[model samples]
Target: MYKSKIKNQKLKNNTYTIAVIGSHSALDVCRGAKDEGFKTLVIVEEGRDKTYADYFKSRGPSTSSGPTGCVDEVLYVDKFKDVLSVKIQNELKKRNCIFIPHRSFEVYVADYDAIEKDFKIPIFGNKFLLRSEERTEKVNQYDILKKAGIKYPKIFKLPKDIDRLVIVKVPEKARSFERAFFIADSHNSYKHESETLIKEGKITKRDLEICGKARGVWTKYMAQKRVFDTGLLSPTEQAELCQVVKNKVPDLEDLIQEYVDKYLY
Candidate 1:
């Protein structure tokens, strides 16, 4: 059963409304909401409406896909912030819609400082803890999880010794989102990763030497990392990811290493 977060207003239709930006994927939030009986309203980038529609068209219930794809409606816009425009407001009003912002969309929304803005429609979830892209005084997502007593992987500046569980990541402020790779247990492995990251221009040797400002204060470079996208790893990179996952399950042992060696190496 679909539990809609659109509150107060009793929309007489069987259709509950949800708004989302279409990200490229077969299984995504819009598809889920649409399957769960909500009339999904997609807000897509100008050229991407077709791309998203096509992707959705490849997979839809009962009738197959296309303009009538998976979602109930698709709205093209110049930018996500334009979601606050009167044009959007009119559309939103028609459905008494629930604005459902995904993580990527919410980042842009937060940049525009768009609060619900008197549209009088309910949002379909808990309040968004807006992330500050600003480097200074920004609340690191990892810190919040830590404060909540969540267990997370070790995070710290590159050190003489790397953690048994490790990843090479870009510092938070850059948001370039340098890829994460397992920092293998051996010192040679750590050095190899450093060289690889430097080669890929993901980080500099200097970045490892000096994280954040030299004010003697520990910065977010020393903070926990958000989850890495293991699926994004290519064959050459999957061995590192395999190593990371294998560390969490030691019993699998040589079987994991053999698979990575045979396929990913």
Candidate 2:
């Protein structure tokens, strides 16, 4: 049903546009496309168009001097999911747009089947990769990482098997996209924190039990007490680690506190 560049003669004109949902890495995608001298389009929801329509909007296609901003055009829709509508798809095809997927696009669109089979736009990345972002998906990021032989945190099959400090990663009850992370040194602490989080409405008990044999199955990393670029500890572990370094580096705790305040909240 969808006519790609190979099938459409209009797309062979060489005037291609880069298009993306107006969230997550939209600015980065638009900026990169603009750098390469291509027009960039951002599809935004009603209340979320300001960033693309005003802040980073370009003056014109190109000027005597140069382009002003990254976002060349902004198409406002009632919702991000509306981008899958026939009207939007037709408009994108007319522009010869290569749609780029991001975290926000996958989350807001919320329909993997439509993205794969219904929406007819030429996607820049593999649409199947979008499903992998969800932890519930059969073939997820963890599966991909394992297949690639990439070293990640070891998952404990059972809570009792946890011999070292490990972080428990689970989806938040209210927000499935966000993870509720906590660190535990043993089964007792793990159970305690899990109960506490359940009481606090941070996570669902069913998800805690079903996600991995042990709730820590998702992300149970050994706390080697060293900072590495590969893995970052939970906020709780970071605070605890900062306390140990506070005595040696008097200002370290303050800096860590500043970082947590600025970013973690």
| Best-fitting candidate, scored by TM-score | 2
lDDT of 1 by residue, 1-265 (tens): 2334433223433366777766523226565555455566777787767755565543444555343456667777888767777888787878767776555565545442455443345665434454433222346565676699986555544444553544444342245333233344545767776677778766676655544332211222222323333433543355333111212212234436756986898
lDDT of 2 at 208: 89
Candidates in order have lDDT scores of 0.53, 0.75
Clashing pairs in 2: none
Which 10-residue span in candidate 2 carries the lowest summed lDDT?
241-250
Collision count for each candidate, in order: 0, 0
Candidate 1 local lDDT, residue 163: 39
Rate residue 245 of model 1 by lDDT.
22
Candidate 1 stretches with Cα past 4 Å from truth are 1-15, 24-27, 54-69, 84-86, 107-121, 130-137, 161-163, 171-178, 182-192, 203-265
Prediction 1 TM-score vs. true: 0.57
TM-score, each model? 0.57, 0.73
